[model samples]
Target chain A: MDIIVSKDLKKKFKLKHGQRVNNNGVISNEIVVLDGFDLKIKKGEFLVLVGPSGSGKSVFLDIVGGLSTPTSGVVYLDDKIVEAPSAKTGYVFQQYALFPWRTALSNIEFGLESRGVPPEERVKTARELLALFGLSDFEDRFPYQLSGGMQQRVAIARALATKPEVLLMDEPFAALDAQTREILQNELIRIWEGTDTTVIFVTHSIDEAVFLADRVAVVTARPGKIKDIIEIDLPRPRDGDIRSRCEFATNRHKVWDALKAEVNKAQQDWKLAPAFAS
Target chain B: MRLLTVLPKSRVAQREKIISLALGGSVILLFLIGWEILFQSKIVNPLFISAPSRVVLAGITIIKDGTLLHHLGISAREFALGYGAAVVVGFPIGIILGWFKLARATFGPFIAAMQATPRIALMPLFIIWFGLGMTSKIIIVLLSAIFPLIVNLQVAMGTIDADLVQVARSYGATRWQIFRTIALPTSVPFLITGLRLAAGRGLLGVIVAEVFGGAEGIGYMIQYAGSTFQTDKVFAGVLVVAVTGITLDVVLDRLGRHFGKWRSEAAVH
Candidate 1:
C-alpha cells in the first residue's frame, strides 16, 4: 500500500518590493525550492531525506505535510490529495515548537484537542504518550524548564498523539547535541517500529539517515531534485553496532557520493557570493 | 548555609537601599526649603499660590467641612463611569477590528481619525447633546479613553508572531479557539497598557468637562474658586486633582506590571 506519492512537484516564489509597484515586479529570478521532485513511500516505510543545508529537503517535507502549498504539483497521501494540513499528516518542526505557555502534558494534548478528542481521553492518551517518551515526570513543567532534547521529545509526542497515517519531520534532531540526538534517533526508530505510521524524516546527518531510515533519498542543492534512493537492507531495530559494520560504512559512503556533487556545487555557489566568502 | 552565603551580598544590596533613601530624603528637604523661602519672600501672593503651610491648613479645613470628601466622591464617581464605559466599548471593538480583516478595513481609518481629533474640543458638543449633567462628563471621558484602547489592541493583534499563528493553524484550531487561546492572550499586554493610558485620559476628560459646565466635581470647585479669587481654595482643588491622577497612575502601573510579568517569563523560553 502506498502511503505518499509526489509527482513532478514544482514550486517558485516571486520576490516583489518597492512602493506603488504597479508592475508584476520582476520575477527577480524564480527560487525553485523544489523542482521535478518525485518520490513514493510504502505504507510504514521509514524514509529519510538527506542533503546539504539549502537542498530544499525541508520544503519537500513541508509540501508532503501540507504546511505549504506547492507552486504546481500534487501530493497524494493514502490515495487522497494532500492539499492542506490535516490530522492524517503530522509535522514535527525542527525547533521543537512546543507552545511556551503550555505544560508538557498540555503540549502533547494539543493535537488530541485539535482532533476533537474528549478531555478525559486526551489526558489519558497524552499521559500515556509522555510516559512512553520517559517524560512522565516532566509533564507538569513548562517547555522552558525542559532541556532542548526533552522539548524535542515532547514535540514528537505531540505529533504522534494525533495518530496520523504519516509523520513528517524536518531536522527534528539537528538542534540537539550528538549524544541526545543519537538517543532520540534510537527512540524514534523504536517508536516507528512499534507503530504502523509511515515516517518521512529530513536531516543533514549521514549517521541519522543510515541508522533510522529504511530508504534514504538524497537531494540536490537549490532547485532540489532527488538524486538517488538507497534502500538499507540492514535488519530491523538498528542500534549503535550497525555504525561499526562495513555495510553501514558502504551505505553511508554511497549516500555521501550521491550528495558530494551537490554539496560541492552548493559550496561553490556560496563562495561566488560575498556573504559566504567573508 | 544559604542564608550565611547571602549575607555579604546582602550588605551590597543594603548599601544601594541606603543611597536611594538618602537621595529621596535630600530631594524632599530641598523642595521644602525652597517652598519656605518662597512663602517668606511673598514673591507670589500667598493666597494665590498658597504657602505650603496654608495649603495644609486649607486641606484640614476642607476635611473638617466634609465638602472635600463630597467633591472627591463626585469626581471619583464620574471618572469610574467614564473610564468604565470606555473600556466596555473599546475592548470588544478592538478585538473585532483586530480579528476581522473587513472590520479593520472599514473602521480602522475612522478610528484613527477619531483618535487624531482632540476630545477636549468636543466638550461643548457633548454638553449640548447630553447637557451639563454627569452624562456629558462620562461621554467626554469615553471619547478621550477609547482611542488608545482600540489602537493598542489593533497593533497587538497585528504584530503577533506569525509562527505562533501558524502553529495554531497546524493544530487545526478553530477561529474562535485561535482567538481565545493565542490572539487574545498575546494582545493582553498591549490592552492593559491602553487601559492604563485611557484611565488617565478619562480623568482628564472628566475634569475638562466639569470645568466647562458642571454643578459638581473637583473641576467645578476649581472653577468656583477661580471666579471668587479664593486662590487658596483653587490651589487646594488643583492639589487634589494632581494627587488623584498620580495615585490612579501608580495603581494602574502596578496592575500593568503584574500582568506584564507573564509575557516576560514567556520570552525567557
Candidate 2:
C-alpha cells in the first residue's frame, strides 16, 4: 500500500481582479491550478515533482502533507483520510522559516516541544539531530548567524526532529550557492538513506529532480495535473560523480523531455501577461 | 608588527562612543558658560532667566528641605500608575487588535479617531470626571501612552511574516502557542518601539495634568514657582522632569536592546 495517496485532487484559486484578462474585455481571475490530479507515494521512497512555477506542485505537496485541504479531492495517509496537520508529517519550506529569536538547537526542539516531549529528552533529540546535520558546533547560534546552507540544514533537521513518517520539502536548496547546493544534495541522500521516512520534494530544477528522486513526476502547466512519472534507474550511493555517468544524463534528459513543453506553455502565458497586467 | 596592526571594529566602536560623549558634554558645558556670562552681565535679566548657579542652588535647597523629593515622589507615583495601567491594558488590546481580523475591523476606526484627537485637549474632561487628583493624572497618562502601543502593535501583528505562522501551524502549534511563540517574538521590536513612545507621552501627560490643575507632584511645583515668580524653583522642577524623561528613555533603550537582540542579528536575513 502507498504511504500517501491523492485521488482526483483539484485546487482552485480566486486571483485578484487584476491577475488575468478575459477576451471579451472582462477580468476573469478565477483559475484552477490543479485539475484532477492523482498521485500515490510509496513508503520510504524519494519522490520529486518537477513543473512550471505556477503548476501547483507546492500546493499539492501541502495538501498531501495535510497543511492544506484540496478543493475537490481526497488525500489518504496510511489508509486514513488526511484532514489536518499532525506530528506524523513534517514540512520543510523553501524559505527556511526558522524563528529568528530561536537558536539552532531551540529551533530543532520546537516541534518536540509542541509535541510535549520532556525538556531533557527534547534537548537530547535536538542535539542528536544537530549532530546528524553536522550543525552540532552551531547549536547555540541563531539562524541569521549561519550560512544559507547551514540554515537550510537546520530547517531540515528541525523537520526530522519529530521523526515524521513523510517529509515534504519545497525547493529546499533553491536559494543556496552552487557549491552549498551540491554539498547539501549529497548530504540529503545520505540522510534519506538512514531514515525509513517517505520524502516528496518539489522543485523547478530538472537536474535536482534527476539527482535526488527515486521517481521524478513531471507536472504540466497551469491548470496542471501530472504529465508523467519517470523512475531514476541510476544506482545508489549515487555520488557526485554520477552526474557524469551516461545513465544520470539520460534520466535527466527524460525528465526534461516531459517538463519542457509545460515550461514553454507557461512562457506563452507570460507572453500574454501584458494584456492581463494592464 | 603586532603593535602596528589595525584596531578591531569593537575597539574602534568604543573609541567612537567616548568621542561622542565628550562632544555632547562639551556642548552642555559651553551652553552653561554662555548662559552664566550673559546673566552676570545682565544681557538677560536674572529674574526672567535664572542662571545655572541659581538653578543648582535652588535644586540643592529643595533637596535639603525635602520639598523637591516630596513633589518628585508624587509625580513618579502618578506616572508609574498611569503608565502601568496603559501597559497592562494596552499590550493585550494591541495584540488582540493586531492578531484578530474581526477585532481589528471593530476597533480600528475607533482607535484611529481617538488617536487623531489631541489627547491633551481632554484634560479638562478628565479633571472634571476624576477631580484634580491622582485619578485624573493617571487617566491622562493612560490615554497618552495607549495610542502608540495599540497602533504599533496592531500594525506589527498585522505585518508579521505569514510564512512564519504557517510553518508553526504546519508543525501542529495551536492558536495560543502560535501567538506566544511566533507572533509575540516577531512583534517584540515593534512593541518596544511603541513602549518607548508611550513612556515619553506618559511623562508628558503626568506633568501636563498636574500643571493644569493638581496641587501635588512636580508639575504643580513648577506651576506654583512660576506663578510666584521664583524662576529658579521652576527651573529645578523642569530639570527634574527632563532628568526623569531622559532616564526613562535610556533605561528603555537598554531594555529594548536586550529583548530585541534578534533584530540586529536577523535584520539582513
Candidate 2: tens digits of C-alpha lDDT, residues B97-191: 98899998898899899999988899999888999889999988999999999888888887777878878888888998898888889888888
Give per-residue CA lDDT, model 1, range A1-278, as digits (tens): 78899988997654333212111343233445678999899999999998776667877777787777888888898788888777787888888877766788999988888778899999999999999999888887777777899999999999888888889898999899999998998888888888999999998888899998899999987668899999987898777678889999888888898989988877755532222110
lDDT of candidates 1 onward, in order = 0.81, 0.87
In model 1, which regions exceed 4 Å deviation? Answer: A17-29, A177-180, A233-236, A239-247, A268-278, B1-22, B33-44, B51-53, B229-236, B257-261, B265-269
- Residue-by-residue lDDT tens digits, candidate 2, A78-165: 9888889967899999999998899999999999988899999999999999999887888887776778999999999999999999
Q: Pick by lDDT: which candidate is best?
A: 2
Enumerate clash totals for all models, in the order shown.
0, 0
- Cα lDDT for residue A65, candidate 1: 73
TM-score of each: 0.85, 0.94
Give the backbone clash total of model 1.
0
* CAPRI-style class, candidate 2: acceptable
TM-score, candidate number 2: 0.94
User: In model 1, what is the error at residue A256, expressed in angstroms?
Assistant: 1.0
| Model 1 TM | 0.85
